[model samples]
Every structure is written in C-alpha cells, then in structure tokens.
Target: MSEHTRIDCDIHNEVPDLEALYPYLPDHWLAYCRESAFNGPDAADYPESVPTTARDGSSPKPDLAEVQARVLDDVEIGILNCAYRVQSVRNEDLAASLATAVNQWQVEHWLEKETRLRASIVVPSHSPPLAAREIDRWGDHPGFVQVILPVRAEAPYGNRRYDPIYEAAIRHDLALGINYGGAPGHPPTPTGWPSYFIEDYAGMAQIFQSQVISLVCEGAFERFPSLRVALIEGGFTWLPSLMWRIDKEWKGLRHNTPYVRRRPSEYMRTHLRFTIQPLDAPPNPLHLAQILEQCGAEDLLLYASDYPHSHDSQDFLLDLLTADQREKIDSANARTFYRL
Candidate 1:
C-alpha cells in the first residue's frame, strides 16, 4: 500500500477493574457497592483473550500508552475509536454507572492524554432512558463521537423500547454504534446456547443479520433519517445474503411491515455502516470483490483493526481491492461515515 491516512474504526479498551469506578458512582451506589463487598462482576466470557493476541500482533496487556505505541503508531492511525468491554451488567442503574465510569476513566486517562483517540459512549443494555441520559451527558464531549451498544442486546435493537435511545443519538448528532456481545434475553443460538466458543463464533454473523433486519423492518432508520448505526466488529460476508433475502421477502410481505416503505437493502445502504476487522477472506480472493459488489458496500464499509482482539492476517483488509478502494477504506470512508 502507498502512503495513506489510516483510521482505526474499532478498538477495545478494557476497564481494569470495578474499584476504578467507585469514585464516579453516586453515594448510595458507592455505599451499596462497598457494603455488598462488590469488587466487580466476573469477567465476561469473550474469546478474544486466547492465543490470537500474539498471533495477530496485539499486546497481551494493552494499556493506553501501549495501545498508542503498538497499535496506533504502528499502523499510523490518525484516529482510533475506542469501544470498552464493560456491558455485562444486569442492573440498569449500576450498569449506567459502570458505563459512566468507563467513559470517565477514558476521558481522564486516555482522551485527555492522547490526541488521536475518540470513543463511543457505552450505555446500559436494558435501559433506554438511562442509556439516553449517558448520551446526553457525554454527547457534546469532543472525545465521544457516537453511542455504542452491543448487537447481542436484550432485544432486537430496533424495537420501540430503543426508539428513545436512537432519538437521543439523533438529537445529539451522535451516531449509534452496535458491536457484538449477546445478552441473556435471547438464546446464543437459534436453537439454544452454544457449548463451545466456535459455536458462539458461528452465530455472530446471524446476530448481525437479525439486527439489520430489526432496524429495517422496524423502521428505525426511517424514524431517524440522520441516524447511522455502526456495526463494529460486525463482519461483511453475511450482509449481501441478508440484503437479498430481506428485499425479496419485503416485496411479498410489505403489509406486515408497511413502515418499511423502500426495499430493505435501500434503507441499509443509507443508514448502516460496518467495520472490517475479521474481513471475509474467501477461498478465491477474487470472490471477495464479488461480495462487495453484490452488497453495494464500497462506501458503507469502514476499516478497523479490532486491535488486541481480532487478528487480521494483514492490518488492513483492502489489499485485494483496487487502490481507490484501499484509500477509501483506510480513512476517507470513516471520515464521512462517522462525520469526523
């Protein structure tokens, strides 16, 4: 690749521990936490901490400066959108406080120190009102560019309950970001929970598909025309298949979802954005190009390292594409999509 601008659209920042959040909590919650002997919730079961870190050039222990030197400076990222791993809480108020603490920690520790860092506002999974309040608090902060939710949400994200959340995003000119992480309300798989990590990994694409369908069929995009949903760590191959399937079904089943006036793909094209971390490298490299063309995703795609988490063979996934595509994926597309 030639000299080009790079912007990392997805990167993980682990909140060291719960004790770090105590200072940000209300007195009652603080007392409750101390009284309950709440050190922290057990670490969520995400599989990224396996051998893939060394395999993919991620630090086993990624602190702010370590990430800055190894991932950001190494790749020459002009901006890195930091997403936290702090969304596993069950209580609404406590969840909001934890999210706030993580953001505050980032603001004081990372954003204030690093010039190239920007982040998503992590919100409580089950509470839209509280989530919206978090957005309202930090939406104006230059360091926070979007509101981040997990695609593995308590419900399909576009349900009416989440309208207030999206409304807050629109009201604040912040994009809504959805990453991977399932909640308990839904089965990990369509049939049942996965027993192994591979099974869980296999279902991630389906999770993304279900989310896009929910957003389109439920008219989330229509209701908030300016609203944009960034699918961080959401891979690309399944998108074409979903677009075709939904548009085909919508033609015959429009009455069931009259709010979706246009073809499903049309709305997705206008409203959704996806990160390219674990890029869909097919057996035949040329076939990858076909997938991009089939899905009409040249502009919709954003480049992400998924730093210290997903291990891409190469830092960027546009090596197979033409030079122009490489340039756009590197920085231009992210600039427009995130309104940076």
Candidate 2:
C-alpha cells in the first residue's frame, strides 16, 4: 500500500475484549455488570456468550486484522482509530475507575498493536472530581488524544457542574468530544416514544446543536479560553443555522447571558472544530462550501469515515472530496485541527 497524506480524525474502532480490562473497574460496578448486560438482554441471559465488542454487523468479535487491512492497506488511511471510550462508559457511578480501565485497555491493546491509532479517555460526566482526576491521570499518555463524553447528560454542558472537566481539558490541552447518546432526558416529544432507531437517530443533530448553543451562549468558551471542542458524527451541518439563530436571539437575550462577551458565531469559529462523516446523502458541494465559508472554519473541518457504518468509509469519502478541495478535506484539515 502506498503512504497517504490523509489523517482520518474519526473512526469507530470497537473493543472485542473489554471484559479482560474489567479487573480495573470497581467491584460494585463489576457486580452490576454481572446482573445486567450493557449491550442487551440476550447477552444478559448468557454472559459467556456475550462478545466484548461488536463491529458493524459482522461477527460478535470482529477480526481486527480485517479492519486494519481494509482501512490501512487498501484505503491508505494513515491514522484510523477511535476518539472516544469504546466500552465501560455507560455506568452511572461517575467513577474514574471505568475511565482508567478503558484508557489502559486502549494502550495495552490497540495502540500497542498499531502505530497509526489513537484513542480518547472516557470520564464519568456526573462526577467532576473523578473526571478531573482521570484527565490528570491519562491525558499525558501518547496513545490518548481527547476527553470524550456523551451529549445526553442531563445538565447542559455549559452548566457549572462541568466546569472541572472543562478546566482539566484546558490544563491538559486535550480536546473535548461530544458524541450522541440517547434522549434529552427531559420531556416527551409530541409523538410520545420513538418507534424506531431511525426516529431517535434522526434527532441527534438537533440535540448536538442545542448543546453547542447552550455551551456557547452560556459562556463556556469564554470561561475556558484554551479549551477545544469537536462535535462527532456528521451532525456539524447543523452548526451554521444554529449559530445564526443564536446570534439573532442574543440581541433580545443578551442580558440572560451577561458573561458571554462575544456572539455565538465568534466563539464557535475560535474554539470549535467538527468532523465530517456519514455525510448527508445527495451531496451538495456548493451548500457544504457555503457552510464552511459562513462559519470561517474551513481549516478546522476534519475528515472522518465513521468506518464500518456503511455510509462512511474510505472509498465513500474519497469520492466525496471535490477535485479542488480534496487535499484540505482529506488531510490538511485534520492535521491542523488535531496538531498531528
């Protein structure tokens, strides 16, 4: 395979043996795991039958060799790796134990095995103290890149409860990643319960937009000057409209957030970077370019395939890049954003 310039900033590398790292977790959490299957009820009934990680609809334990061969050897993705917690993050204890366990697992297993991979450390979002400790513990590891949390937390990210986590991110120069999780955990929609995964997943972009707005309007960026944020998945297209709306509304609501010294769009361009993956279909290059231009973030945009998810893969993205913007999308952007 020929060497490539592109550095894939987003990839979904799953864990196939998270249990082997279970010893690092606290005993009480292990007991809970023994009772409930984190994945599903079928795995709950037969713990032995449960595979530690499942990939994109392949074997319960996907062949790692196959993934590397496809992404590296075939497609030439220079750095194909996970940027968030692969396992043991769903627990509610907000303990550093799970975060440490997952980081150790990535180092001992994935990073040790491949030179072209990096990972994010997962922290308990509900417990700032423990989360800060975990950031202090693993932020220096060469294999670790960012601090990741699901966007479904009950409190808006800019809430004071997350100040410590943001502080740790600034202290360690680690980027903060917000990935989609579940419900807003607030009120029900007009349709009541979602009937399908599509129904729930379709709303992911809206939720992400809310968090970004909440953080920006609530002065998170102002409070943490050095902190960086990346909205994972292809939800970034929502940013332009959200930022515009926030700016328009800020005129009438400036007093509501007196601490925010700048407009929402200003903060977004200064501190935020976004990943492009599983791009919305019927690709509109002009529309995409317009968004990039309006946000003043063409350089901060990063390339990601969300591999094994079908819609995003090396081939798909390679095809999506235009003749003129290919280099910027495929490599230069990620290299600049990640400081690679």
Candidate 3:
C-alpha cells in the first residue's frame, strides 16, 4: 500500500427509512411492516437533536456521491458500519428479517457500487442463532469484512449463548465489530437510567470496559483463538487503567477462570483492535501520549473518521505519535486486521 493511502475502519451508511429497505426485505416482512404500520426501529443512540449526529453542513443521509465528495476523497478505503438499530427490535423474527434486509441493502446500494468501500454484516444480535445464521448467509461476500453487533446486549457478548456468533465469525475469517449503540431495554449505565443524554453518552466507555472484561474473563478469546474484535466509537483514553486493573485482579482470581490461561491484558492486546474516533483525548497532549504508552497500543489502534458524527479535534493525539506509529494507526493496522 502507498504511504499516502488511508483506511477508515468505521463509517456510517444509515438506512434512510423503512421504505428504502422494502426491496430487500422478504414479502412476509414487507406485509408485517405494512399491516403493523411500523415505520422503522428507533436505532440512533445519538438523537437527531444532538449535534454529534452529523457534522456541520453535511447531509444526514449522504448518498454515494456525497460520501465520495466528502470522506472518500480523502481516504483510500472506508468500511461501512450501518447503525440501523436492528438489535433494538424486541421481535426476534422481525429483527432477523430486518438484519437480512439491511445486509442486502448494503450489498446492492453501497458495496456493489464502490470498490473503495467495504461493509460490516449487520445481525439480529439479540438472537444468537439468528445472528449466526446471518453471518453464515453473507459471510463469504468479498465486500463484507466484519460482523457488527451492538455494544449493549441482554447479556455480555462473551456469554456462552453468543458462542455461535463467535464460531460463525471465525469460520468466515471475519472480525467481530462491537460498535456503540443499541437499545437492549436496559439502562445504559450500571445504575438506573440517566436523566440527561450527556450522562448516557459519558457512560459509554464504562459499558465498553465491562464488555472487554466479560470477553476476557469468560475465555472467549481462549476458546476461539482466531476471533478478532474491534471496539468502534467507544473512546480509548480509559484503556490503560482498565488493562492494569484487569491484569492485577486476574492474578488473584485466576483460579476462578482456569480457561483464561494468560493475563487478561495480554489477550486484549493480542485479539482486540480499537477504532480511534471519539478519541477522548485530554486537553494536554502529553497526557494522551502517556496513555498510549501505558497501554502499548501502537498496533492496536485503527484510523476512523466516524463520519457524520462530530468529535473533538484529533490533531493533538496524532501529533503525539511518531511517524511509523501514525502510519499504522492511519491505515496499516486496519489493513492487517481486516485482511484487506
């Protein structure tokens, strides 16, 4: 790859409306939507009122040409992570149908049209069996590079019930992308629901931490050695402390989890990659450098614009990294992780 080439690991290509998916959905599901008068699942984690939902002067639903004019013109490749909120629906059957429809929509509307684009397979993650089947259904498509599940779920993703998802993903050589957003009907935080959207947004890193710990201690990495995970849109500033705490605690509790043979941090560094959008950098540039050094995350970070969502300037963090490290984070890491 050229040194100038860049790969964006996370980008959104939202479904404009239920009508857009009508062609992809089966007749049964089409009838269900019509008879129920269901418009679509309310999937946006960041409300439309929130400024972070879309950048200034950009269309909410950007067409391929707009995306090319804006984002693709700058990068060599971009992976589409459709935050369609298929996981939010309570009806498992309908959820599965929507997941299939979303994947087909990506195939026809996005992937087939752009060689520079790749997509993640959207799944009905609430139903592991259905999610696994969806992975199997589209796993072989060259345009899809990963399987995306929501960060919030009924149970932690590492639970035995999700083994089918892990198995199918590994079978397809697809990375498991746990992207931020999902309405599991549970409070976003460990406590009850927050009164403000700020509280909900700030608590996302905590949720991501819990999922990381769950995946490690539950031995998901041990059982499925080939499995790879990308934590998208969840900030990375908290990782150093999380890694230290988990590793320290694992030593005392190692007897409880005999399957987790190595230190938790080791498994995390080995199997996980994090997208660097919503970076959560501190006001001081040196602090960000220290955090990166503490976590030893040079190879683990991937480039992402999290297009359509606004975030604090990343120039400070980028300036802190060396040229080689910057290259890896810019595109090399993603290329290696996604097998592009």
> lDDT (CA) for every model shown?
0.75, 0.63, 0.89
Residue-level lDDT for 260 in candidate 1? 88
Q: State how far residue 312 of model 1 sits from its true place (Å).
A: 3.5
TM-score for all predictions? Answer: 0.92, 0.81, 0.98
Candidate 2: regions farther than 4 A off: 1-4, 26-63, 74-95, 182-192, 281-284, 312-324
Residue 215 lDDT, candidate 1, scale 0-100: 90
Model 3, span 96-144: residue lDDT tens? 9999999999999999999999999999988999999999999999999
Best by TM-score: 3
Decoy 1 TM-score against native = 0.92
lDDT of 3 at 211: 97
Best by lDDT: 3
Q: Name the runs in model 1 displaced over 4 angstroms.
A: 39-49, 52-57, 74-87, 314-316
Residues 170-283 of candidate 1 have per-residue lDDT tens digits of: 888888778766454557667877787766665777888889999999988778888898887768878888898999999999999888889999998888888887775676
